[model samples]
Target: MHRARLARWVAGSVLLAAIGWLVSIAEAQEGAAAKAPAAGAKGEAAGRRARAGQLPPYYREVVSEEQRQKIYAIQAEYNSQIAELEAKVAQLRKERDAKIEAVLTPEQKKQIEDLRAAAKTKRQPRRQAKGNAPAAAPAPSKPAPATPKP
Candidate 1:
């Protein structure tokens, strides 16, 4: 029992040290990036943040290997159900959007497309300045000026 406790303590200590080392390395890289203004450091840092895996960050520190495996198994079991629901939701959205589009006149639709293109053009220079690719913006929802009612 004493030996088991000692081993667990040693393992935990090593894990903590490794985590600390990794954190320091990340901080060092960030510091270097901050010092170099032309490097587009913020975009790189944002990309790194986005790449954090699907697991909660705490899982890396607190969860035992066995518990992690069990959690992964549970997630796997739910994944198929989640995927099926997501597909259904997507199909429903597409059908709903088609119905909405059917209600709009061709002129209104063209106007919406024009507004979206304008917004995209306005955003392009800002994205380029930030060293990021221009992403498509959602179409502006401003309804055309209501024609005077008959």
Candidate 2:
């Protein structure tokens, strides 16, 4: 019983250390292309974040060697399929971005890049008070001209 507990602890510690090392290594190029995502890519970004934020299968669990081997076998069986699908998705995304970029004017492309950078800087949601009402009625957007048409 004591040996099993010790072994689990050691495994958890090693797992955490490896994850930390990977994060540290990835930090260098984390934002190389943070800006300039194609339109509707926000949903894709959120999906990626949701996946990354999920707990791993068998996370925080200690299992026997046989169970671990079974889990690994299952993982190995699916990993290749997952990799192939991921590569195809990446290729599709790249082609989609290229098509969109091709249609944009130089000025429009620059504006999109600037807007993307600003969006990456922050995501601030509008705040509403107790009542869902505007602070005040906006002035007439297009007031009548002072003089009538001659």
Candidate 3:
């Protein structure tokens, strides 16, 4: 009779242990499910911010291997394009300045220098006002003055 009672107690303890494990598993699954939507929402917000030109928090750290390769490729392309454009612009400016030098007399060169200085002065206020103004406006038509009778 004591052996039988011992066997029943062991069986009951095993059953209770199994039940506790299952309850713990169920609770973990429930907690994970509850947290899933919050994680998804945060991911979506980060994506939106990145699209709007704001860097995600992860961007503050060292980039991953894949991202580093991508950045290197992009930098190489930009550098190539910038070097090409700078060469072209420098050539164009050289040509323009040479032409201007050839065309101007000494007096005209002095006048051109004065004009350039005046234009630089005038440009500052215009540049400051440019952001607030419309880019262009319609031209006004002028009425012809009265013509004398033939």
Candidate 4:
């Protein structure tokens, strides 16, 4: 009777251990599946990833063809409106510049030109002149020499 009881206890323990092992394996799989989607989650999570430059501009990973066409159409409409507005703005700026130029003296115009040259140093990077190599960064300015005090 004692041997029988001992065998039953061992069997129960093994059953419990097997169940625990199965539960752990199931939890591990669930964690892995959850991790992947969480890392590449859609909507704002995807947008933030793109903004951080971690992913490409288009983050609609599994978009259907119908949805893609609709997105393209919407983008086209916005782009057209943007181009129209930009052209109007450019025309208005040209008119404004002409009006301002009409008011300024030659000396003031020279000063404005100097200011514009200075502003250009703040710089949008220019494309490379020829080869595949990236354009060099602007040279560092030399520090002004200090005048010796008498």
Note the Cα lDDT for every prediction shown. 0.64, 0.58, 0.60, 0.59
Best by TM-score: 1
Cα lDDT over the full model 4: 0.59
- Per-residue lDDT tens digits for candidate 3, residues 93-150, read 5775776587779999999889997776555556657774444432344578799667
- What are the TM-scores, per candidate, against the unseen true structure? 0.49, 0.38, 0.32, 0.41
**How many backbone clashes does every candidate have?**
0, 0, 0, 0
For each candidate, C-alpha RMSD in Å?
23.3, 23.5, 34.2, 28.2
Give the clashing residue pairs of candidate 4, or none. Answer: none
Q: Where is model 3 more than 4 Å wrong at Cα?
A: 1-72, 124-150
> Could you tell me which residue pairs clash in candidate 2?
none
What's the alpha carbon RMSD for model 3?
Answer: 34.2
Residue 148 alpha-carbon offset, candidate 3, angstroms: 29
Ranking of all predicted structures according to TM-score, beginning with the best and ending with the worst: 1, 4, 2, 3
Give the top-scoring candidate (lDDT): 1
lDDT of model 2, residue 119: 61
Query: Comparing candidate 1 with candidate 4, which one achieves the higher TM-score?
Result: 1
Q: Candidate 2 lDDT, tens digit per residue, 1-150? A: 789757856865676566556654564355355545676775655454444433356653877656655555445434544565557557755775787598789999999999986664333222123344445433334579999998
